[model samples]
Target: MNIKIYQRGGFKDNHDVLINATEYFCKMLMSTRMCNTLNIRLEMRSTKLGKNGLGSCYTDALGSKKNKDFIVIVKRDAPITDQLKTLAHECVHIHQKATNLLQYRLWKSDGKFHARWNGEELGVYDAIPYQDRPWEIEAYFLEDIMHKAYFFNNKNRPDLEEKIINGFNNALNYLESERSNNYRNIVSRQSNSLEMAI
Candidate 1:
């Protein structure tokens, strides 16, 4: 149930960055009510990432009974703040999978089977519209929230002052949107129940 951090592509020179990020992320997750005594392995790696990819999170298998190991890979040379944001983003994916809100399945392709999210075989990573992907939208919307809280609480990183402000604003907006969505769901459910009773 330990979080293991690894470095590569010269990130070893800034080993402290990886350690600090892992500690902060782990602490935040531990504090959450949903995460009661984390028993899953979280592997955070700082290494060369795909072009245009700041970070990414994926598991060997996606399900409650299968492997719960989460592999979070980030750019080795990114700024500490940016790296923290990536960690937050990836951690959201881990949380989603752990909660069963996000699930995957294997699909046949060219005589081979490939894994995909929510059973959408054709919806490849980049092929899926950014906003249409609920998982990405949730992760992207919440990453800034987590980063802002961490940076504000730390308060020693003046270099990230601007980012902190931006994150704060983004978090507020996301919270509002989430509230609205929740209200809508409740109302729709109530209406359906009433109609069924009638």
Candidate 2:
């Protein structure tokens, strides 16, 4: 999948700021050595307006693939360095998809699609398990390594730090429990189906 990162801005300052964020994220990804394993293509662009966002992976032809060509677009208003965290978070999903980690992540919950991710299943575009699994553990670890001590401490973005810790911890726990329950049910269903088929 080709993932494009777009930002909004035409000035030199915008480039400098955005560059700061991009370098940090790429370095993190490179250091993690994830790029060598994941085949997804990534691109970055800047925009002048719109909420900083990441994503792209519409289903493939015939609705089998939820989103094939992925794109992560972000606005220039956000502190580029901080926004990179969001990219890191999403990039983990891309990694999961590239490696088929998703096959084990999907679970049916209340007739709806769900994953261990902080976001909804809709984010993954699949009722398929593991499609949109949570990356909270990875996100938190990366945030601490990349932001909490350096950016957050030096910039005094305590509020951001509080939100990251609270949100990541709470979301990860909920997602884990939900995923476990859903997986159990899915296994039971699969077993029953196999028995019936035989």
Candidate 3:
């Protein structure tokens, strides 16, 4: 996936970690072909969200049957662990949208948001409580598991922790040289090593 992260308000110190985590989530949830076709933008913001909201995922159709473009807005002021968990949660929603497992449509006549899950209409969106939403249920269930898998449960990659530490060091260098117009591209190249490590 082509993932771009914009640090808008605060918590700008962990770009590399965020990038690696996003790539990991994409790899875990989607096939390689799907991953290659996706264009994901992650916006980190310090603004407050409703209630306990930590992040949200907005999927766009991009004028095609396949919805390949997505924007994920995450609360930046939260702890890094919380940020990663929220990111994992949003990534699951992206996967759901991409695979057509979850979808929403607005009815002009009734002005109500309708949801469909696995091709079955689920009635008005607001009718379903937050915890009862199937999509949210899946996302919430997998968030911490994905986070733990990326960090602690990667027994197959014994060197993962070392690589992440090294990636953070490289991130500092990248931040220092971020004035370059090709900074994103540069970080993309640097992230390749971490991806391999993952």
Candidate 4:
């Protein structure tokens, strides 16, 4: 597993700065995810795949018969929230590809861009599992949870808890709208699935 993050020196506004900081934290937190799930530290590596203003991801499918582990790349200067969302989205892709390519779903396909997934849309996470649109909903939720976690973990934040709560509420609004009825269904199914397996 590989997760790399870089900062671009040119940030013109406060929002831009926040976005940059968010990207850095989000990338680091992704390593924690990889560690918990794959039981290894995700390596950080610089890639020549795409320019900072654009986006990118690459993989070799290491350590298993299928797409078990792989390399990923992204430009250093993308928006933090959007980029974090994309990162979570791409991780979902890796999960999908590993699950016998059954989970990979890119709706309204664009050109070959790994991190710039789904489409040029607001909610990219919900664009997975093609036939089952609920995956994107969960992806968006995961991104928010991670974002709030990052914000709360940030020592520099003056009002960290408030910011996290507000961000979560905002995310909930969007997810509630996007997932509609399937939100409860998905959560219920997930709970039951875990219960039976455990």
Candidate 5:
């Protein structure tokens, strides 16, 4: 798979170290057709988005089949595993956009029309129920599998299978942690209510 990475905004301070890592993850995550035909670019920036989130893929402006180029933006300073995971997630979105699986649900507010995907409103960054979003769910489901595959294919150790399994387990643990964080507020509220009742 042919993957291009562009680093900006102090991203080179790390001594241009992550190019190979990003290239490896992109090749492992993206499909063979996409890797071979389209020129995929990953843009990395070192900036804090303040809870808005980690990474994103933009494919809305271009024509569907003709413009096969897709962009994935990620925080340059994020942990390597997180960077990989985020890339994998955005890769799924790219596929969805490429294959016409990304359909918008239009909603009118204040006489203005807006688009959304799987009930998550687009253009606006208001908090949405993330775990319930179908696209996010699919991405979450695929990220770990992709990670495992990457490890399996890249590793040449005698315990290659073990390393692959460990990769899967590590990603699953990360997903569980995300799920816990997502619902922690609700759990805390319920606990407080129960304590009050007592």
Candidate 6:
């Protein structure tokens, strides 16, 4: 996909790492053809998202068939691992929207959001609890798989581990060279380093 990243507040100093991670997440979640046709915007926000809200995905169109553009917002203050997981979760939503597996509509009469899964309307969005939503259930299930595949299982992508290690080291080196206390703190919190696991 044509991926654009915008960072605000705490994430402004780590643009390169976010870009690399976004591209990696998109590639992992989307097919090559789908990637070529879609445009994605990932916005990193340092603003509070309330308790348990890590990220969200928004589409250009209500119907999945017309939704080719997506905007994803992620909480930047979270740890790197949590940020990546949230990205993966939002990426799953993008895939869901792009493939017409999930769709949403806003009713002007009731002024409420409605959702559909494979052509079945599921009532108002707010009526269902967040965790009980089918799309969320699917995204949550896939996010763990994506995270594990990226960090642990890479038989299908033998070069992935090495690439991640190199990228992680390069990020650390950049942070050290810049000598930015903010960047150092960011890296320190990401103690769940790829190098440590790999």
Q: Best candidate per TM-score, number?
A: 3
C-alpha positional error of residue 161 in candidate 2 after TM-score superposition, expressed in Å = 18
Clashes per candidate (backbone, < 3 Å): 0, 26, 0, 2, 0, 0
What are the lDDT figures for the candidates, one per model?
Answer: 0.60, 0.43, 0.75, 0.45, 0.59, 0.70
The TM-scores, one per candidate, come to 0.61, 0.38, 0.73, 0.36, 0.58, 0.71
TM-score of 3: 0.73
After superposing candidate 4 on the true structure, give the runs of residues whose Cα lies further than 4 Å from its correct spot: 1-66, 71-75, 95-132, 156-198
Ranking by TM-score: 3, 6, 1, 5, 2, 4
Off by more than 4 A, model 1: 13-17, 26-48, 64-67, 108-127, 156-198
What's the TM for model 5? 0.58
Identify the superior model by lDDT, candidate 2 or candidate 4. 4
- 105 Cα displacement, candidate 3 (Å): 1.4
Which candidate should be chosen as best, given lDDT against the real structure? 3
TM-score of 6: 0.71
* lDDT per residue (tens digit) for residues 7-42 in model 3: 765557898888888988887778899989999898
- Comparing 4 with 5 on lDDT, the higher-scoring candidate is 5
Deviation (Å) of 48 in candidate 3: 5.2
What would the per-residue lDDT of candidate 1 be over residues 1-198, giving only the tens digit for each residue?
346666533636545655555556555544454454344333434444656778887675443343456667777667877878888888777766765556664435533333344433434444556645667766766677677767765787755755765665565465446553643543455468779999
Model 1 reaches what TM-score against the true structure? Answer: 0.61
Residues 1-198, model 4: lDDT tens digits: 333334345442444443444344434333445433431122222345444422333454232234444444433445656555555554544443443332232445562222222222224433345434454445545555655555565656648756665665576466546554557765666668779999
- For model 1, how many clashes? 0
**Which RMSD values do the candidates have, in order?**
10.3, 12.6, 15.1, 12.2, 7.6, 13.3
